[model samples]
Target: MVSLTPVDIEGFTFLAISVELPKTTLLVVTSERGYIMCGALDVGLLNERLKDRKILAGRAVGVKTIDELLEAPLESVTHEALDAGITPGMLGKDALLLML
Candidate 1:
């Protein structure tokens, strides 16, 4: 199951989605500014690593998860996010701009 809500932040309105799957849940907030995501962050390391540095390129954030998520280390990021000065240890919420 997935639920979507409208979010207002930094004068921009974006869509936040919560996805429930058999093994995990995913949380995502997306806008023209960027995309923030976590929980079951990634599936495979090698494939993800390459794609992370390429397509995602600082526009995405990934984090590991167990049960509910609070604060966790970033597992991967896109180049655009890196350009935004984001890195592996930044808090998920902090990495996301205009988060509510």
Candidate 2:
């Protein structure tokens, strides 16, 4: 099951997702403004993948989903970033702004 709730952390607003599974709990956090930060388990892996892609794209930050992002071989995840028009620097700034 999945549950969504609004939460305030350090003054910033976020939407939290609680996923109940057999073994572990999964939490996904998205900024109320639409930025996704860190999360649990596979979510962290997804964040790392996106972060790596952002760096390769020459920008600071970006927003993406595993299903929506482009898959590139031989090149970094930059293809998705380029398609999304996000810069690595912008990713960083936005992440900071969202307090992620």
Candidate 3:
């Protein structure tokens, strides 16, 4: 299991997702709008998956923009996570560092 923390980005909200891999843990930073800015890649499958999906694929995967987040409900994030095959249970302790 991994943990994540919520962060604030220039007044926008962000969250960190910590995933357990075969050899190491990955920490990914995602905006409230669902944009994954950066993080660590420790899982081979995850690395491959990310590589297969072009960077910024989150936009097409259902992650919204700042404007979208302003109007979207919190459930939208959960829905996006589900669509991405990421479980809320899997994102418990990662800290969401704010980017201001």
Candidate 4:
């Protein structure tokens, strides 16, 4: 089953999804400021796969599951994300801001 909810974090509105099997929640955040998806088992793989896609969904973040993502002292961000000043140890909440 999948559950979706509108969530507000740090003044950002995000669409949150919960996947039953993986027990992970995917958040879709988009605005004039930026766009990105947060949640997954391997953030490194996530960025790699999307590296060439160049879709409107400009960013993909692997928080390594729901908890790890919400508490992102560790993350595998895309190169574009890197250019935005988001680092590995930066919290997911903070990264969300620069992802644009």
Candidate 5:
């Protein structure tokens, strides 16, 4: 199953997406500039192999739902995200605010 919803955070609108698969679910919240995703995201690849693309994103581990993903602290973030002031240990919601 796949779900996509518009999420409001401090008056800003972001897109929340969830994809359910066997034994796992993929979760993500995205704004116009960046996004935060569940453990399925490969921060390393985004930071290194795709550095030229300058993707702004973060990853949170152990989040089973979009709400959890929003509340969870980021475990890793892309280099562009770092440049944009998003960092590991920052809450997913907080990181998103920076992306705006």
Candidate 6:
């Protein structure tokens, strides 16, 4: 199953996605400029192999739902995200705010 939802934060709209497969689920919340995702995201690859893309993204581990992903602190973030003031240990929603 796949679910896409619109999340509102401080009057800003962000898109939340949930994909269920086998025993795991993928979760993500995205703003216009960037996104935050569950452990399935590869922050290292984004920072290293895909650095030129300047992808603004963050990853949070151990989150089972989009809401948890939004509330949890990021385990890692892309370099572009760092340059944009998003950082590891920043809450997902906070990172998203900066992304916007």
**Alpha-carbon runs more than 4 Å astray in model 6:** none
TM-score of 6: 0.98
Mark the regions of model 3 whose C-alpha exceeds 4 Å error after superposition: 37-100
The C-alpha stretches of model 4 lying farther than 4 A from their native spots are 22-49, 54-68
Clashes of each: 7, 10, 9, 0, 0, 0
Candidate 6 residue-wise lDDT, 1-100, digit = tens: 9999999988999999999999999999998899999999999999899999999999999999888998999999999999999989999999999998
Clashing pairs for predicted structure model 5, backbone only: none
Q: Compared with the true structure, what per-residue lDDT tens digits does model 4 show for residues 1-100?
A: 7666665677777655555666555554444454445644344554678667433232235554444455555345556566677666676556666643
Give the TM-scores of the predictions, in the order they appear: 0.55, 0.37, 0.33, 0.59, 0.98, 0.98
lDDT of each: 0.53, 0.38, 0.37, 0.53, 0.95, 0.94
Please write out the lDDT profile of model 3 over residues 22-90, one tens digit for every residue: 865544556443343212322333335554543221211222233332222222122334455543223
Candidate 5's residue-wise lDDT over 2-98, tens digit each?
Answer: 9999999999999999999999999999999999999999999987899999999999999999999999999999999999999899999999999
| Candidate 4 worst ten-residue window by lDDT | 53-62
> For model 2, what is the error of residue 96's alpha carbon versus the real structure, in angstroms, after optimal superposition?
6.7
Worst 10 residues of 2 by lDDT: 66-75
Candidate 1: tens digits of C-alpha lDDT, residues 5-83: 7765555566767788887667776665655666344524423556554333122334333211224555666665666
lDDT, candidate 1, at 97: 56
> Best lDDT goes to which candidate?
5
Q: After superposition, how far is residue 54 of candidate 3 from its true place, in Å?
A: 9.2
